[model samples]
Target chain A: MKSQDQVLLSVRNLVKNFELRANSGLRKTKRIVQAVSDVSFDVHVGQTLGLVGESGSGKTTVGRSVLQLIQPTSGEVIFEGQDLTKMSFEQLREVRRQMQIVFQDPFASLDPKMTVGSSIAEPLVVQGVQGNHHDKVAELLDLVGLASDHAKRFPHEFSGGQRQRVGIARALALDPKLIVLDEPVSALDVSIQAGVVNLFSDLQKRLGMSYIFIAHDLSVVRHIADQVAVMYLGKIVEIGDKDAVYRRPSHPYTKALLSAVPLPDPKVERSRSRIMLEGDVPSPVNPPTGCRFRTRCWKATDLCAAEEPQLEIRSSGQQSACHHPE
Target chain B: MSESVLQIRDLRVTFNTQLGELRAVRGVDVDVAPGEILGVVGESGSGKSVSFLAAMGLLPKSATISGSVKLDGVELIGASRKAVRSVRGKSLAMVFQDPLSALNPVHRVGDQIVEMIQSHQDMNTHDAEKKAVELLEIVGIPQPDERARQYPHEFSGGMRQRVVIAMAIANNPKVLIADEPTTALDVTVQAQILEVIQRIQQTFGTAVVLITHDLGVIARVADSVNVMYAGRNVESGSVQSIFDHPSHPYTRGLLSSLPHEGIERLQPIAGFPPNMLAPPPGCGFAPRCQLAIEACSAELPSLVPFGDLLSSCIRADDLRSGIRS
Candidate 1:
């Protein structure tokens, strides 16, 4: 692939299964939970692809599987012309230098005993980047809009927003090409969430880093994502450009997810008719026979229960897995 | 006009800390009519939570509260320990943000809720357990009988919050205070929780004080909105008035900065919230306000009535004239 046209990371037919124990004490009756089944997507250079789903929809599992943090049962993760799944431990460790992850909880992710500066410089030390780590630490802090003086402070001393900045600085320490932000700002206050999000956008612009931003909030995804993927029970129900997917959602699950987001304006919230999906999300271990969302989908039919629909492009690069597409 | 179910006047709450006395709430005035959901919107340390904690007499011994908190014309603030305890769960109850931490880990969910009802009212254990199941059903928890027997860890995050709500409303308090109730749940589940709260508020006709940082959650449940900053009320009005024509610069900035549905890009407000320990001398939001002036730094502004709204900014007159920069 040409340099500009090269796909930074491509996942094909990724399948991740967990051997969860059944309710009974029978070890013979082992059950498997298909956390991610046949999920495929590509992350281009300097682009962001958002993975959105409600709780228990396996969005986080997909993100972790891409990083090879969890070994996938079957699939290919082609990153920079190498299949990460087929790589050995040492090869995967080398690949990890080019990819980093910013976890959801800033407090939990950072070591409580370490200072913020030491935490950010830890990756450089591990990679044996020979230099004055203090200078690089200050530079990383400045990049994420933190003061140089904040280097000495521990994570507990800083506010929630500042700690997230520290997390971002740590993510950038390795000079990675791709950063998987798994709900980076979900644990923050709204005002603080905006600051961190803006910092992410600016850093992406400055460093040209690709991001796989995973979040359940559609509004936050809209501001950051170039491409959007809606997942339902370990499957990509819809994937398209930000505007096309949000403005004209093809799948019923995508539409319901969009309609469920509450608008800031009271008048608009009162006037808008919401597609409130009834019933809870089914278990992933034994999901519906065909379409996972067919149980609660309004447009589901007998055909939906019998035949699994493949994700296909309908118009203008927008793909959706639905028997009845809007 | 309907009688106010709860009236709070000049509420001042301060916590005695090692550093000094930290004034968390300063001269807050709030009133809630029957069946109205009053939203208190602000970032952390804005005194939105502290104000209600003082009203409910839920603060610790270190907290020094001076103000009148009246629920159904009965004073709560500065009441004796026994008197406050007597009215706490019966007349006014609060549901905290994290239900997992709020509920007892060792006790069954039903027992904890039953304890809440029995402590305030003269009910037997059997009757209280019956009432607890009724509350679980009221909050829309399926299989209430079986779910009630489970521990806090057995239920999901959303279900745990429902159990917390069940405990709060077990005594049928006249006023309910939900402090960031849906902050811990997912968006879809947050909507469901908010809808359940709204439905319960309507059914019980309880005055609710919904405290949260999310403007979207506020919009869905609030009949009135209060914009707080640095331990002070910057703006207060009917929800429609606040959304349509916000008189304060801080309120306008907050409303505009929110990422609404169908909007692609968000306009983030510059600067951070003022430090409550050492807030600015005059208007708390002057440092972040785009339309701030030298006069705004000279004297603190009091709540003044605008067109169908109340704002503390001196430039409220100019706010509607489109002079905000």
Candidate 2:
């Protein structure tokens, strides 16, 4: 709902291609996997923009690219009016202090040998912050609803939820303006996931930071996001206000994706109709021609195959990339 | 319950670990009637999977399993190795969460199914191969003959799951225990896999014991649900009653915490699951439960009959009467 001037981060025409070696007989050919393509979005200050898609949708790639954790193949990742793609390693390193990311598995993200306190303080030491590191670590631990004493324990000492809290506290160590949360709560139990999600909301409100919350669970995304972008095979198919997208999903894939999520209510789950997509997601190496979702999309036609659909504003006020959006 | 295909009574499973005797499953009872889908729903370490694994005799030597696990009126615990093996694939089959791990990567998909079929039944390889193809077809694998020759890695995650299901049902087992079968899959693919399982259940009248952490999955497919807490069945009932009137606080907390249509914010359960090695003397959920009283921590509340269900909460009446917000 914020104006364009309030944008914390703006991504334009972003693309990431990974080169993979394919062996045939004796010779090896370089096959390009189009992980992310022409993805554009904006994250407003203090708001959460959810990126949702199944595996291989390149949602994770988009998140990593925004932080310049993995440099984008091509496009503009403008943060506070500065293009990150054009920045050198040293320049990007300076900018990295403002942006951070939280991975799905907290256990894997944290070093097993290191105490959680050290893990939280590592970012501060790396960025060369002028402060009592111990106090800052304690403050951060408290901020994430964990006791300061927990910092003394190793990563394995904490529960899954506690470890995730540690992951969040570490991300917050640098006082980042934007955090790219790549499936932060996916690995936790459903009950524990809620607590983490609530903590994210509370932290955003308190710290006034923006978040690009990447997740495959649509319901979780709906619960947390202000803006929602639905991706398919590297390209964003639909993107808009979370309410607009959830209430009236314009893209066929979005509609199907929404329908497929089984509601917890037994009566509703039983009575509701589901859109069962026929086959697996097409490989990123040789993505379907024109529309990436055309193979699974029911409304696909000759036009969909022959010409790629540009993302246009639909009747629901959401932008959808499809020849015939539902 | 007399005609139940699978009956589990007072089932307890403990693992000998460095810390202590880690009690994974403790005094749980479950029954799955013929053609019924019994959903064993819980979080990680709730012992939903461990209990069923103990029943399947799949646990390692470190596990000490006791109590009764009756499949088709036959006791599996303390049974002879040959007897357990004879009934495992033929009468009681299990489909694991990861299809890639369940299947042998080196063997052809069809050959694996053939091997499974030929293991218990005295059938020729040629006939078993034909039967394997038929099973693949039944699981909705298109171009079955051509696909059968492909390796496990060649198949997609969804397709690999279908092949796993095909192999599990190859012998037309009376009971099928699918443990988190769709957890690793995408939502769309998960729907397809659930449909396949439903089809197989309907076509063969096979009793299903579906273990999952997702309540939504249970609601979508389960006839009856057994809600597991720290290694115990906290609540068990028809899906309608379990969803509509959750008697246990843990079950209620699990439901309310889910991201649904109208909820403003999630009401998360306050604390972590108890440490199994040194779990509290009373109710396992007492520490986190909002409605817990002095009595709740003092004594373990037994599963007593409520309206259309059994609840372990002593304050089940208070819960049903809307005492708490």
Candidate 3:
């Protein structure tokens, strides 16, 4: 078990709300989309906490809130014992060098006009680091398993995987203590995705940095994540060790999510019974009252609709927020 | 294989681009028996989608296509436009990945299905409307009659895909070519979509050719798999043979690279897929193959049978005998 002192980032009661204009009859009514609500987790040093969820689950919003990229409406993001939400612009800028993000689309993230070398060195220049930018760029390129010569090439010249490596190299240019990788390998092919995932682990081991690896792919998360957190409707439905979560999912939603992921082995895929959750995810603008997942949950009762379940230690050895824990 | 509902032999497709001839699909062969799901798995530019598109005559005029594509013993390639059109939606229906784009934005979902039925068959509007609702119900849409009147935007991503599946099966086509039908949806929705496809295949006895890159999806639904790399078939066999005993290095590399339960470090295949404009001589995957020898680059390896698999690797026998797994 990890000690409390080893926690690199601790988030509590994270909430993000977005305003939307809706037309009801002739009048345009303002609607608030509660994208993220009361989300909390810890990312320990030299470890990874995989934040997983389907679309509209607000997994991306939670990652952004942790870094103050998209400022949360209300939350306590304590990084190194400092609440990021309370930091001023100047103070946040100083802290920004130690935290970085790698986006999902490598192609869109990198500037097409700029050379890969300059793109990597932008962080160093922005931070006002006293060093040779060219050498630093080359070093970063080498660090990301790319040839140093690749520094001169534009983003268009690189393949999808190489562009992603360049993205990682840019993220590494600042030598950040924590990196929030938002679906970094989702765009690459399976063969290319493995290399990048391995590269991430390799970099983590060598640099001793922590990661908030946010992705929808459970199988990919299972391989890299030390701790796993399953998010649904902007809430952590389940949180525990990767082995415990994967082996015996406690929450009904988590069980259904895991069951939905098809195994590569045909025999296993054929034999394993799937917990097919009926109906689509409810609109986040007006999420189902009480338990957000109660609409599709087969075990839901009057109690589930009357009161929201809180994350509690379950019999399956994970913290799952469910009225009826399986 | 001769009793296959859809048989593709020596299928080849080339596009005349600005750079040069982009040979999207090299010589390839596939067979889909009635009620069987044939998964054509490959990465981007691997021609998994293109091979079937050529068969369906869906490709643009710039591409030069050849070889035989027999759907129910009728030749598709070089067939007359009217002949191909007549059989396209009637006997060979196709479902695409993006459903929103496939469906008209202004038209009601039911009207769209009705249009498809009217275009293919001589059904009356009233009967077609009733059939549309029935198809929606069959695809597991809630309140099919009411839902059919709704627009495409009204449905969720999963529901849109189900609507697309309903439209594809409206004519009750003998063969359905679904190109990444579930790729655009979420995992849970993908599960539902796969279930719908499976149910359609079972209920209608439709021979389905599913094109996708996700190995997991392929494993779950496919009876047989055809692995494509750099526009050619690298491996083809039953799902068990392909997953359990991958003979080709590309297939083996692909299987090993996937992040699964027991794998600590992924063994990613080195180098990217070959440039299709001017592919490497000999085996297309030779440059990336870890076990590639001098002879592997000498000539293109043909799909030769190795036990239950038809693998394109020259060292398939060695791979089968565990010389280097």
Q: Score every model by TM-score.
A: 0.92, 0.98, 0.98
List DockQ, one per candidate, in order.
Answer: 0.48, 0.86, 0.88
Off by over 4 Å in 1: A1-5, A21-31, A111-115, A131-135, A149-157, B105-115, B121-133, B143-154, B260-265, B323-325
* TM-score of decoy 3: 0.98
| DockQ, 0 to 1 scale, candidate 2 | 0.86
Candidate 2: residue B315 lDDT (0-100): 90
lDDT of 3 by residue, A1-326 (tens): 65423998999999999999988999989999999999888888899999999999999999888889899999899999999999999999999999999999998999999999999999999999996989988888889999999988899988999999999999998899899999999999999999999999999999999999999999999999999999998889999989999999999999999999988899999999999989899999999999999999999999999999999997767899998988
Report how far off residue A217 is in candidate 3 (Å).
Answer: 0.4
lDDT score, candidate 2: 0.93
lDDT for each residue of candidate 2 in B7-82, tens digit (9 for 90 to 100): 9999999999998999999899988999999999999999999999999999999999999999989999999989
Query: Candidate 2: where are CA atoms >4 Å away?
Result: A1-5, B323-325
lDDT of each: 0.88, 0.93, 0.92
Report, for all candidates in order, the number of backbone clashes: 0, 0, 1
Candidate 3 lDDT by residue in tens digits, B178-242: 99998888898899999999999998898899999999999999999999999899999999989
Best by lDDT: 2
| lDDT of candidate 1 over A34-104, digit per residue (tens) | 99999999998988999999888788998899899999999999999999999999998888999999999
Candidate 2 residue A40 Cα shift, in angstroms, is 0.8
